[model samples]
Target: MSWKVTFRIYYEDTDAGGVVYYANYLRFLERARTEALRALGFEQARMLQENRIAFAVRSLSVDYLKPARLDDLVEVSSAVRELGRAQVVFQQQIVRAGEMLLDAQVRVASIDPVRGKAVAMPKEIREKFKTLMGTPA
Candidate 1:
């Protein structure tokens, strides 16, 4: 099952023409991922506070399948597509009602908060992610 979150497309999220800006979709996808983590009981800020580890976007490749306009209620569906010792890849999509507006695959790497270098994800967090991945919780 996919984790879903919805948000309104505000005017600020759009360009002068009122279509959601290309870059803002990335932001939307990020928010969905953050909320997904929160749903899994791992808050990024608190994780950094306790483990000194944070996740950073390593790379993103998005496909703009359609345009979403201001006032549209868009839902972003997210799911963990892959997991690694130091990184995770998520497959997410932005949809307006029944239509798909965008889909993206994002790679995020766990890093040491102070040094900003790659680090293995904590086992507890990994286990939590596994639950989201359809393994036994």
Candidate 2:
């Protein structure tokens, strides 16, 4: 299943031509992922402080298909594509109305906050991700 969040494009998200800046698409996707995690009962800040775990992007690839203009209402969608011991790969997309504007694959790794090294996801977190992966694409 895909987790989706809607956001309105503001002036800050755009360039002088009123089109969203290419880099801002990454930020939009990030927000959706954050919300998805929250929906699963994980809050990043609390996880870091209480669980000593943090997440970081390991890799990302994006395809820009169309430009989103200022004032457009966009939906960012995210779903787990692959789950691993130390990393989770997510497929994400940004769309306006029904048109896709960007597609991305983002790999995120769990880390030991103190050691700053990659680590296995907490058992509960891993289980939650597994459930998400089982959802229909």
Candidate 3:
């Protein structure tokens, strides 16, 4: 299933032209993914502090289709496209009033925060991601 979160574009999020800065789209996508994980019963801070595990973006490709203007309300949607032993591929998009604004595919890898090395996700965490992957978006 897809997880969605909405954000309002503020002046701080925009450039001099009043359009959302391109880099802010990454922040929107990150927040959506974090919220999605929270909805699935995992908290990133707890995961890092207690389990010593943190997630990092391995790679991403984004397409900026349309610009979002200041004061606009945008929705960010995220879904698990693929799940692996220590990583997941997320298909995400940003939309405004039903119009697609951006499309992205992000690969995230679980890692040991201290060592900064890739690590296998705990069994429970992987299982939860599997469930998400099986659900319809």
Candidate 4:
């Protein structure tokens, strides 16, 4: 199951050719992931404040299959693919209507903001993420 969110491509998301810039796809994926967390009652800001930890992109792989033009309505779908003590792998896709435009796998790591090093994810947060992973979009 996956979490889905829709957004329109604004001019700012496009390149000079009027197609979405390759990098903007990453931004869209991030937005979707954040919203997914929010839907599960997790807020990044509060997580950082209360847990003293933050999530950072450790690595990502993306493939673009189609181009999205400005003003096009796109949907971003995200799901947790793997979970570890200190990291999570997110599978995400960008689509127009029912057509997939891009797909990516992003690995995010939990880090102690003060020490700038990896840390275990809080137990409650981990449980919530696991629940979301099995839920339908």
Among these predictions, the greatest lDDT belongs to 3
Which 10 consecutive residues of model 3 have the lowest summed lDDT?
Answer: 128-137
The clash number for model 3 is 0
Model 1 alpha-carbon miss at residue 133, Å = 2.3
Worst 10 residues of 1 by lDDT: 128-137
Question: What TM-score does prediction 2 earn?
Answer: 0.95
Off by over 4 Å in 2: 134-137
Report the lDDT tens digits of candidate 4 across residue range 13-37.
9999899999989999999999988
CA RMSD of each candidate after superposition: 2.8, 1.4, 1.5, 1.6
lDDT of 3 at 15: 100
Residue 86, candidate 4: C-alpha displacement in angstroms: 0.7
Considering lDDT, which of the candidate structures 3 and 4 is the better prediction for this target? 3
The deviation in Å at residue 125 for candidate 4 is 0.9
Model 2 collision count = 0
How far out, in Å, is residue 73 in model 4?
A: 0.5
> CA lDDT, every prediction?
0.87, 0.90, 0.91, 0.90
| lDDT for position 71 in model 2 | 97
Span of ten consecutive residues with least summed lDDT in model 4: 128-137
Q: Pick the winner on lDDT between candidates 2 and 3.
A: 3
List, residue by residue over 54-77, the lDDT tens digit for candidate 2.
999999999999999999999988
User: TM-score, each model?
Assistant: 0.94, 0.95, 0.95, 0.95
lDDT of 3 by residue, 60-85 (tens): 99999999999999999888899989
